[model samples]
Target chain A: MYGWIWRHLPGNVYVRILISTVLVVGVVFLLFQYVFPWAEPMLPFNDVTVDGAAEPLGTPRAGGAA
Target chain B: MALRALVRTLSETCITIGLVIVLFVVYLLYWTGLRAAHASDDEIARLHKQWAQGPTGSAPAHEGTAGGTRDSGHDGGTTGGADELAGDGGAGDADSTAPGHRAGESFAVMYIPRFGGDWSKPVLENTATATLRRGLGHYTGTADPGDKGNFAVAGHRRTYGDPFKDFPRLRPGDPVVVNDGDTWYTYTITARPYRTLPGDTGVLKAVPEPVDEAATPFRRSGRYLTLTTCDPEWGSSHRLIAWGRLDATRPTAEGKPDALTREGR
Candidate 1:
């Protein structure tokens, strides 16, 4: 996948390096700012509330009280 | 030659994946804390600015009526003398009419001297992940500060500034003081941190009765404060709760409460 991206980049070797650096930074920014925050609630690390949907001990029980 | 090239590519991919996983962990543990610190600072600053401007600038007409009724109700409390003095000075007017906090809006600043003299966090309106990232979150539908019910709040134990990172250190008789621009509400810890499953919402009730009995069980409805957080430091499989009761309330005009000023507690 990375090889394909490198090969398809439209630039000389130096320019390609610069472009790839920018693209990498952009990808990391998007992942940190959007993807990770959106995905965080799905993970159990930060779950502090005692609500039904976020119970991590086991599969949420049937008719479990919130 | 083909096999060698494929092996090189596969190794490169694996290394990239590993680096990304490491980066994500750093983001979770460090970067989020940085961002949350900035957010919490801004929220607290905003709250202070709003409070300094006084009630006329923000409160609606209907809120005046609400303030009147609330003041009357507070006057009937056992601590009626102070409430009456606050009312007479007109300090309670702005406090009672303080605008109802909207979702994600910060309305209070909490100080846990047990954490440190400088340990303070803005208490926002809701407990959503986004809101908790900024500071401690006031559990919606619970009692307001100084009110006659549980004024519950939740914070992260690990990341996003870890406002309650020292949650387990809280012991009975420690003080958790809150400032809502006009009054300082001091709550005395009634029990050590209680451990329970995430499904036990009873710990946030007006008169809390956690599924696991609290070390100091509350027997009556009264002004209470509950602080909750994820347990095990880095895990969220359980919740740790600390309960407190309103020990005293003084108008901010009266200066810092004794719970905050006394040393060597």
Candidate 2:
């Protein structure tokens, strides 16, 4: 798909490559500085923060309640 | 001529892609590492200055006066609080969660001898990525070191000087020592490092599961030290944790604690 887009771009090979690189980098910079932080709260990166939640020891001893 | 132009376009695209991949490698591994190293160095310098000038045994950043526990025992010397930072061992936890103890502020120093004889990293107040770049960051809302709950911290496992790179090398009973300016809190590694998902906050709790009331810090049976880092060294899909139980606390004035003295462990 990207190759098809590249084939259709105007200008010589070098100019097109330069334009493509610039566009890609710009998008990446925007995502890192703005998009990622904004979306982090909705992500699973920091779900468990404090010492309040628990995981089932699941390895309960005999007669231990689940 | 048409075939030649097509070939030229394809080659140029391939070379551009090669360059992009190389640059991305440099950014991910070397660039971030270099950036974090500089940030941590500056943070270390700032902490040293604070230790030098800030009043020893200073009040917690949030509340309470120095007078609340100005003499919370551990003051063995009759000459008054002249030699060490605070030199007292009371529940100085009063101000641990104070708002002033925000991210980026270096609050303690983590000493893991396995890293090096002089391996001491600043312990920042929060575990945010920016804060971890500075040094190991304490998890907010957890018990402070020597307190009866979990004194948890997180750090980069691979980048930013790889503070916890040798985490798996710690065996049960290895000492994970922390210095909070005035006192040394020693903890012993409890079990093999545990693995958990990033969302499983259960490991951060005072008790791992079921919230055993009897195992809480209030009952004094729940003291813990947890060190977390991204597992597998190169990804963050999972987390590796080291658990420890508080072993001892000694006033800095008392000189180096047994853990530091037993450095080979």
Which candidate comes out best when scored by lDDT?
1
Candidate 1 to truth, TM: 0.81
Quote the lDDT for B189 in model 2.
Answer: 83
Rate residue B231 of model 1 by lDDT: 77
Question: Least accurate stretch of 10 residues (summed lDDT) in model 2 chain B?
Answer: B62-71
Give all candidates' CA lDDT scores.
Answer: 0.73, 0.61
Compose the digit string of candidate 1's lDDT tens values, residues B1-265: 9998899899999998897788788888899899999998998899888888885232342222222223224322333333333332222223322236677788889999988888889998777777888998877666668765678888888888878888899999999999877667888998889999888888877778788663545887666788888878877789998999887766666778887888424
- Per-residue lDDT of candidate 2, residues B40-132 (tens digit): 777778766776776433335411222223222344233244335333344424333444455458877888776777778888776555566
DockQ of each: 0.29, 0.07
What's model 2's lDDT at B86? 36
Report the TM-score of the second chain of model 2 against its true counterpart: 0.77
